[model samples]
Target: MTKTLTIRRPDDWHLHLRDGDMLRAVLPHTSRDFARAIIMPNLVPPVVTGDDARAYRDRIMAALPADHDFTPLMTLYLTENTDPDDVAAAHADGLIAAVKLYPAGATTNSASGVTDFTRVAPVLERMAQIGLPLCTHGEVTDPEIDIFDREAVFIDRVLDPMRRNHPGLRVVMEHITTSNAVDYVKAHDTGLAATITTHHLVINRNHILAGGIRPHYYCLPVAKRETHRLALRAAATSGDPRFFLGTDSAPHTDANKLLPCGCAGCFTAPNTLPILAEVFEQENALDRLEGFTSLNGPAFYGLPANDATLTLVRETPEIPAQIDTPEGPVTVFDPGMPLNWTV
Candidate 1:
């Protein structure tokens, strides 16, 4: 067995570092391994403009530890009223890396998301012209759609048509959770890709509901069946440039998560690297781990891979069950098995 593995430092293609105290506490976890991350824009008020994105980036920089060399790549939250000019200007100025599309009410703090796709057509057109990418929470929010079926339905009903309309637009189906998503991205030749989260690869729907309600495993575009989890594992380890790491390591205080109507997210930032190493090892695809976690994301985003490298030794370490923050305690995702790798 390969005992020690060294690869280019990875970048998290998608991440959520919430504001204020939460941000301060969680930022270090991600900075520890990832060289940079595409920061999510779905805060309470939401980051809908170049100015909002810039301010958020500044806050992230402020919260970052002085010794860390991590960069927070900003993104704008697309709204029905999003100005095409502002988006173009932000991308041109390098203030924002991409624009995030959250269908209104799709997930936490998504009330300000786009309710009318047509209203944002001009913005999408401008993005295509500028070669800016659109990162999406790819699920339809219709009340009638079975929660489990939303992702597949979104592809057939929303994503496919939108892609056909804007052939030049680059889109990332963020934190994709199903085989349908896997097949869809594979079938599309270019201008389309998907990010698979670390938590999704480890847990299936059963982990959330089988024995008892496990709030820590609950997240939007929730974990799918065992078969879907297997598919995601296969795609992520397949060495496909279109599939890459995006931890989507959202943090919610224990109070909020264990409530009657708990928030949706898994705080996986702290342990993602070790868990990933273990998963890749078990799949007997350790050779492809570098591409999946480190190389593929940068290749898809047209950015240079990190010059630095991270070394993971095959040594077991005990992972803490939870991390305490000023706001409250946040649970760490337990992969339900001991991890034998450490970075």
Candidate 2:
């Protein structure tokens, strides 16, 4: 029998399609490529309850193009006041796919995030019992901590203790940028896994500061050293089911990004899969792409693998060097770069 290479359609486990106009502008890109996505909850006010999350999910559906099969899996924003029983009920009801935990003052529109882990123990305990995965921002907000050290530091200081305290908990270390995160999750290896973003696999800190201050490349878990990037590439291409695709494809308006105090996130949803193929090809790991992009995520989340198929042809194509929006033109991570494959 001849071995066939079939492209399995993938779901984005982590994503940030902001509400209203921004959501409208970016939803099409992801919907066009992904069958489903676990949508982020860091909106302006944030989606904090089952009703809020469900309502927000409705809005995303309303914003989506009617003919597309893209399903937005909503998640509630975990705050210090989040009720555990309510959290469990929501997850059990299938109103939410997961619960997002953002340390207070972490990223865009996360002002209402949990200020201390202790404050949210009730909710965390409930989520653990209900089998609801806790997706994390994985950063320490303490200004004294080195920006590059935040993710690893959080794992050591916060995540480790929390995981140990609740052995039943399921954690997804979202947007992992350092080897520490990879090591920690693998060591824990029970119901814990991590997400590998398309940008971190391809770039390092130098890419952000080499030429100038590149606001477009700025993101939470800010890109790390070259060695870390290498580790990320290795981990992503290592054929590990523990690691999977989560574009974290957050889009910010040009004005918001170019400001002195710009927001943090990368808008890679439009070019996520195409770039993943190129990276895997470069690593000579094209064979493992499906597992990382499609299988691993759903399997970890206890969902069935996607039966639908997608195609990625080896072809040279051009992407805009930047995307022009009502706010302004923002640079794209893989923009205009020659790619070996596109989906």
- Provide the overall lDDT of each model, using Cα atoms, as 2-decimal numbers: 0.93, 0.85
Question: Model 2 TM-score?
Answer: 0.96
TM of each candidate vs. truth: 0.99, 0.96
Tens digit per residue, CA lDDT, model 2, 254-341: 7888899998888888788778887887788888989998899999889888789988777654566677665566566753356766
Task: Show how many residue pairs clash in every candidate, following the order shown.
Answer: 0, 0
Determine the backbone clash count of candidate 2.
0
Q: State residue 325's C-alpha deviation in candidate 1, in Å.
A: 1.0
Residue 31 lDDT in candidate 1: 97
The ten-residue window of minimal lDDT in model 1 covers: 314-323
The regions of model 2 sitting more than 4 angstroms off are 1-5, 324-330, 335-337
Tell me the alpha-carbon RMSD of every candidate. 0.7, 2.1
Tell me model 1's lDDT, rounded to 2 decimals: 0.93
How do the residues 219-265 of candidate 1 rate in per-residue lDDT, one tens digit apiece?
99899999999999999999889999999999999999999999999
Top candidate, metric TM-score: 1
